[model samples]
Target: MTNEFVLEAITREFPESVLLHSEPYGFLTLEVKKQDIKKIIHYLQDSSLEINFLTDICGIHYPEFQEKELGVIYHLHNMMTNFRIRLKVFMPRENAEVDSLTELYAGANWMERETFDFYGIKFKGHPDLRVILNDPEMGYHPMLKEYKLEDGTRTDKDDKMFGR
Candidate 1:
């Protein structure tokens, strides 16, 4: 359906969570509060739209940004209408916790795992939360802005030498 209709439905069902609505690229993008993500996602899945297809879920980290140090972006699509929507939840660096959508969307399993692997944002109730790319010995998140090279050294050498 139309972006306005989808946004109206979201606002009606989740008055507290709908922070803002944006129509970028002619798609509905709903910015939601992190604390109310679970409820909002459930509402979207259960609505008449039935946007049960979760195309992707990714995380972004910004240490210098004041509003939110981290964010998790969810991309969902409606198979019946070919409409798409994006849901984003901003979170702080410390105590970053958001409800896992894996229960509602089984495809979220790998996406959430990848987000946790890169941004260190914990997905509560995730069945298998583990490192997807980095090794177990790596302590710092390479994606965050706070990440620093060891000893402040600069070189063109491969990172494998520093224990990649």
Candidate 2:
């Protein structure tokens, strides 16, 4: 199906949930309410649209945005038609949490865990949520923009060489 048709169907089904929508590089991207993400994804999967494959789930940190400092992005694909769509939900950095998609897509288990490990975005209702790539004892989420981009204390690396 065409992007407009899918967008219309979703907007009709979730009139209040969709905040913004755009077609970038011909891909449908939607910014939706964080609370309704699970419901909207469920509808997309179960409805006639059949956008059933969960391609990926990732987290983003925008520390300067205040209320919208942290975000989660989800990509879905309709394998039969080779159509893909993206959905995003943003929340305050203080409470970066969202509904876990593991219940809907089995592959989401690891993706959510990785997002949590790197960006500190908790996935509520995830059965085995824990640090996947980082050490369990690590206290900070390194992917966050709050962290330093380079270690100033490293004596071996000269800042001048890097034009810093």
- The backbone clash count of each candidate, in order, is 0, 0
Best by TM-score: 2
Q: List the residue pairs that clash in candidate 1.
A: none
Estimate the Cα RMSD of every predicted model relative to the unseen true structure.
4.7, 2.9
- lDDT of each candidate versus the true structure: 0.85, 0.93
Candidate 2 residues lying further than 4 Å off, grouped into runs, are 153-164
Cα error, residue 125 of model 2, in Å, equals 0.7
Candidate 2 residue lDDT tens string, 1-164: 99999999999999999999999999999999999999999999999999999999999878778999999999999999999999999999888999999989999999999999999999999999999899888899998876545687987765456443
- Runs in model 1 deviating more than 4 A are 148-164
